[model samples]
Target: MTSDALRVAAVDLGTNSFHMVIIEECREKGIVEIDRVKDMICIGRGSISTKMLDEKAMQSGIVALRNFLVLASQHGVAREHVIAFATSAIREAKNQDEFIRRVKDETGLKVKVISGKEEAEFIYYGVRNAVKLGSSCDLIFDIGGGSVEFVIADSHGVKLLESRKIGVARMFERFVLNDPISEHEIKLLEQFFAAELVSAAEKAVELGVKRGIASSGTAENIARMIRSLQGVESDVSLNNSIFTRREFNRLYRMVLPLRSSERRRMTGLDEKRVDLIVPGLILFDTIFRTFGLEEIVLSDSALREGMVLHYLQQHYDAGQNSDAPDIRRESVYELGFRCNWNRDHSEHVAMLCLQFFDQLIALHGLEQRYRELLEYAALLHNIGTFVSISSHHKHSQYIIMNGDLRGFSPSEKEIIGHVARYHRKSPPSEKHVQYSQLKQRDRNAVDVLSGILRIANGLERGHRQNIRELRLACNPDMITIGLRSHHEPDIEIWAAELLKSWLEAVLHRTIVFEPLHDA
Candidate 1:
């Protein structure tokens, strides 16, 4: 690989295993996956029900991640750029903190624990990039060891997202006690899954989603096993392929009578997943029947691919107007809409923030990266008002920290949250835990962006869009902001003056607000 080639790796610390893929992404060739590896750690095999990750599972996970790091280093991937995330098993485990600490201590890899909704969102991003669902709506499902994610979406955007704690490992540990699970157990499992999926299935039906897509290890194993049994030569590198309900039913029936030991000899089936296959098959069968789907397209691109695609979309050809792929300003605004925010006020504030950023770039000494974060902060600063008007800045920080804002790393998310949190009364300080936790550079970013956001928010204090444009005249001692508006803009100017102290302190210049036009 040349120096210019972008080599990145994504690690998914799943319940059943740890998966890592290295890819060299480029504009001309798109994403070229260089290598992929999976280790069957089964970290959730017996831990899901107990809510504890046993010592053996923790050690296995650490070893797996360490080995993955070695491979990534060998493939020329930068250590800091490697992305690693943990899913349901770790999220639900009581000893998760210990596991994370041990992994970091042994392997020097930071792991982000993501929520089920974020998991579903990432899955949607992966499928949207890999498979072409056209304009029609399609339901996508990913069954994991500790949970299952379902998403209803079209080519344009996702409509419905749901995730449940009804994964194969969890089901098998709870229901499958006998070899080739008993009919009573199967009946109980089916009832449980149907009850859990009732709301999502109804939503799918309401959306008129007839077609379906399935991803994750369980779906991939089933599709490959069925193909292998039908004398189809399995291609190791194949992904985003199609499989049918007929084929799934055939494999389900065939595996029903086989013991785990016998199933180990099956060509398509992964030996590690033999014990859990019965529950996996049962879960898929019930889902297919519930949704009235005859076929499902399979995407080998799961969450790991989703992370890589997000990274590429954010880094490649950034700021272009030609339909930025995933995680653009559109997605950020979509999140604001989901929170039922005041769109007019958020947009007006964001516009003013950007205008100020552009005009005083040299004074602030900030880059484009912080500018994007500022825009998001300005748009979502008032979202906490949905919770309560009093101390809404804190609420905004909480929301941004927890919300599913895609294409941002965990650190970046925290930075954005800090920026939004300081968009109001209190400025950044060493006493604020969130603000102080950031690195010095990030702390500086929060200070500068928050100062600008506060000024922008004040400029739109009336929420009437009275301030149409702003022109800044920068001098050594003071700066004059020329505001153009259709009204007197008294409230806007007063609010800005009140919040200009932080900006003035940071820039060492007094801010003076003046009206360019008065109607």
Candidate 2:
């Protein structure tokens, strides 16, 4: 019994259906679900043949949108607070522009067509907010109407985000034939799913992920089936339910031989989902077989919930300050400590690196996050020494790649790991997996910032607080680094020779390192 005040709404214009959720945010009672609406418009059904939405589909979609708009208006949701997004159906349709324009004209809702990656990210954010996951790594599988988005990440950040073109509705339309699907057609569907699952599993392996959890309609059905077969009460909650692989296989085998009517007659089968249930089972069975996952935890929340949580986190929670240690700085400091790196030397080098980063920010168009990453790389340039004194650069790469660094996204971690790898022995090259993952913009930032870190690390090689200051002068073709220190020139020369090659390769310019003496 909570007062319904301060409502927020999220609308999902999905490929198979239109869904809307209205939540009342209450401080004492937490989020109270006020209203929800769902309509199976099957927008993708129109685009499958013509690669554009058909007139009938457009009309159906309009009806659903109009209904959703009325619900939002009734709840007094503001235009700015109501977020709407469309998926594969809109993204793949040739007539998307007209459809979007018409929808906006009629319903006054602006729809954002998001990419698969963004979709996966939103889903992950949503699950993290709603589900209480144990310490084990989580792989979120979202099976929608036209596509399945898989995301693997821990509490740290997203490690893998990939999408495949297989969903319950799409699979049914493509392969599930016969009233109850025939054995021959079920086998065919299984083969097709098995192939796709193998490829996706291979990709997941490359990213070092093993566990998985289900996030959407198909998963909910599986949970429902489990509950019914166990003779659990219809009113039993799904919050603590779990489905084992063997049980899923049993359900799969049982459903594959049944006709659409037979499936409808089965317990816990929703009438609206009867046509798509066989293919959905096939998809799930294939995924479980391919990954060898023992069991899957079902999450009631998926994309819509994820979208709402993400919006709230970005707009509300992000503004509040917390006392947690800055993850970026902590990661950098830990890297140095693990390497047994000279603290005085690493800090001195980092100072010079930051100075260089600030000097060329305009030319590089680097963001503040990149600057933080650059500082991290500069501090940990010598992390490889802990493994072996020689070829420590390779060791540094291995450690950074494997170690869990909090507060860094997968992309940020890849950049920092690559930058650390390139500190001593090599320049950025496409041959390296981590380096190749960086976007063009980030690659350029890593290149310039890594150059600065290399030179700084070289300058502080004496390991005795010898280098007091560095004076940098940059010209069109060559940059000069002047080291002011009382240390022997031999120590400076040894470090400078290594710096020269790395600087030349990174900047494509000649570098001269010199030690200065007072007059």
Candidate 3:
């Protein structure tokens, strides 16, 4: 679609409600929110018990979707341009297939069920796009109908993403029994939330995250309430009227004792959200206490906004490169510097490893990312010798896994850790924790990269820079690795023998190491 003619719409099939936003994308004027709709279906209310969407709840959602489809069509939104996603409730429901089929039949819109990790990614995109919070580290919280997603990301990328079962609708249905919410019940809920918050907070700290951004209806409502109390226009920017922990706690305490009816009478609390206001407040307060956040800027956008941005970035702007640098390399380089490894030799080993990887890419089918990881593994393979000589590979694995790597995802870190672990030992196995944590694809990548690193490390064993050049020739039966060096064949032979076993185990075939006397 042309930039000016492009019209995009997003539907968030939330647990408590179905929400949609239609935006007209004008290149010169920027994006304009032209139409918005919300239908409170409470899909999570019935999903908790049967692990299946109740028939009545399914009908409620279908009706809402049909109405939305009509509205979208009226607004000139093409069926192909509209993106619809279902979150926690529908994703967890056992009979979601029937519900989705019915929705598709009635509304003509395909519903995409997103996992919690994907949900967190979209939320990050939304908050990052909507707000100009200058903080490098941000903790984003989205309290939805059935689940709460917490993400830690920065200009670099997502560091940690987690989702929990505590949400506004669930909290109210499971906890608040009294109209005003009795003090006894309040205490019990507070204790329960506190425990969860504490664990989440610890994990966030461990991941080196700071600052905070609140997203979704619950957080936005709190921001509106705070704004109304302060008598300010809600521009929804971080600078003007963000809430400090002290002020947030004061508001939480004030709202805690009020009845549901009384809460509706409050300036910022929406009438429909009265019953959930108490639980939402408790969630906010618990997070504040757990993280010890001084203040948090409220974001007007959440998962739906993020999803639209992601789709646009992926399809419309194909030239944009968002992948961060290789975190593993940075970590290894830093560790090597700290351990006082010979920089010349370390870099030489890494360069040779990458050279080997590039020459064998067609045969191995490994991606460019794996080559980068192998470079990193080679650089820090000898770092463990700083502590001791025996089983330095084990020490290196622990260090790489625990160290802070800026550009790597949790999955990438697992692969890097395994590659370093297997540099001088047997190939990665199920018994290895780091290897086990990785998905199958990543595990395979680690195995191939580790195999290459093992050979590179062996070739450099002389530590005197004896080997000059190497060539790799591969076939279905075996890999013929030829080394060109100026020195005697004794050192190269010993190293080649050590690498042969690892190469064979990884490729499940024989490996022949050949040494060339002269160029």
Candidate 4:
């Protein structure tokens, strides 16, 4: 929403769903998600065998896009900025042109039907950013409703890119005949998949692979169901979360023989994907057995994320900023950029925070893990100012709570939010319901990390980045911190002296701030 930010929407018209992902390209900050909406219109339903668009499904698809444009407008995505791509189902359908024409006439959006190879490449671009997929050999594959695209590659670059017409929807229409799908059907489906994926499998073996990365709704559904069985919290992210062969086998066994009704009641199974999951299971199991992958990493990004990246690459020079090494850091940086944060001051505070965390480790007794949480919290401590400077700390906590930060587990994100929440105002208290919801260990993390952030923020008073170095000395009863600054340290010393009390209480020591004049 900044003056320089260009908000755009990418619409993926897949066989089973109509999804629109809206993002803003914020210069060096990279792509930040603005909003996304999806409608499971199943536009490709019955089109696999008929080789034409279904009238009802096409009508529903138009409605979905019409509504998507409204959402894009709400998010400030102009018509010219919206790009819609139809894959697999539409690409092969005879009436694809009619559907595209109706959509454009009604919604003012042009639909580009992309080929299978193009889809695979776009997916590669998408998953690479999310999963850090620059390995010596990383196999990226996405199983869509109508086709599954496979890409075999390594750090050097892509080795093989292919697509097959064995998607879950196609298999479901062709193979699924019974509720609780019989043993005979399972064997037949596996045989078919074995034949279809033979080439991709052979290449996967020839090239050798470090890991398999699965991106698509089917993969995410499976990961979630498995995690549900393992009792993972619902808020925890499935992005880059892994499941071993054993885990997949366990889920398959539970799902394979279940009736449609039974599967519908299952935990973590999306109601929309209940029927498709049967064939989905067979396809995924076949891929696993075919490729000899011990484990697969789940990516939240797929074609939708790829579309954003591809668009950014074409329009803006966006790709892999070394400054933000991982998705977690990049995601955090994007959120900070969206809020138009004072990067110099936030980075300075974060720098000071990490320094304090290392120097005070003995007193704090916190593990190295807390160091990351502290740093992210410091970087985002002022983002609430995006909403309004008034009680911006509260707004900051709210924003961080719902920012949907990728690559961070729910607990880690919660800890970061709580730390940022307490950066300015009162410390964590029992009366604050959100703070009280945390576990004992997490509450302690918030307390200590926020305490560090408070002093760091205080030292950077006036956003001057004056404090260059910190020297700490511990005594039996009191601790003294020496500050070295390029300018006079009167304000920083005065501000930190006031903010050090919360940290003193947390560390159970009296604290003193002294300005050091070094020759």
Top lDDT hit: 4
Q: Please, what is the whole-model Cα lDDT of each candidate in the order they appear?
A: 0.83, 0.73, 0.75, 0.87
TM-score of model 3 relative to the true fold? 0.59
lDDT of 1 by residue, 208-278 (tens): 98888888878888888988988976754335456778988888899988888899999878888998788
How much is the lDDT of residue 235 in candidate 1?
59
The RMSD of every model to the true structure, in order and in angstroms, is 20.1, 17.5, 18.8, 4.3
Q: Candidate 1: misplaced stretches above 4 Å?
A: 236-238, 315-519
Q: For model 2, how does the per-residue alpha-carbon lDDT over 281-388 read when each residue is reduced to its tens digit?
A: 888887877777888876656788778867766777631122222434654565565456777777777877787677655445678878878777767766778888
Relative to the unseen true structure, what is the C-alpha lDDT of residue 207 in candidate 2, on a scale of 0 to 100? Answer: 57
The all-Cα superposition gives candidate 3 an RMSD in Å to the true structure of 18.8
Candidate 4 lDDT over residue span 1-519, tens digit each: 668888889999999999999987767667777788889988889999999999999999998899999999988988888999999999999988899999989888999999999999889777777775555787899999999999987645678999999999999999989998999999999999999988888888788876899999899889889988899764555776788999999999999989999999988888999999999989888888888889998888889878877776677767543222477778789889878899999999999999999998888899898999899999999999999999999888888878867767567778999999999879889999978989999898888999999999999987898999999999778889899999899998888877888989998899898889988
Ranking by TM-score: 4, 1, 3, 2
Model 4, C-alpha of 183: deviation from truth (Å): 1.8
* Candidate 2 collision pairs: 179-260, 180-258, 180-259
Q: Cα lDDT for residue 503, model 2?
A: 52
Sorting all predicted structures by lDDT, with the top scorer first, yields: 4, 1, 3, 2
- For all predicted structures, in order, the TM-scores are 0.61, 0.59, 0.59, 0.81
Better of 1 and 4 by lDDT: 4
Scored against the true structure, residue 464 in model 1 reaches a CA lDDT of 96
Better model by lDDT, 1 or 2? 1
Task: Give stretches of model 2 more than 4 Å off.
Answer: 1-5, 26-29, 203-210, 318-519
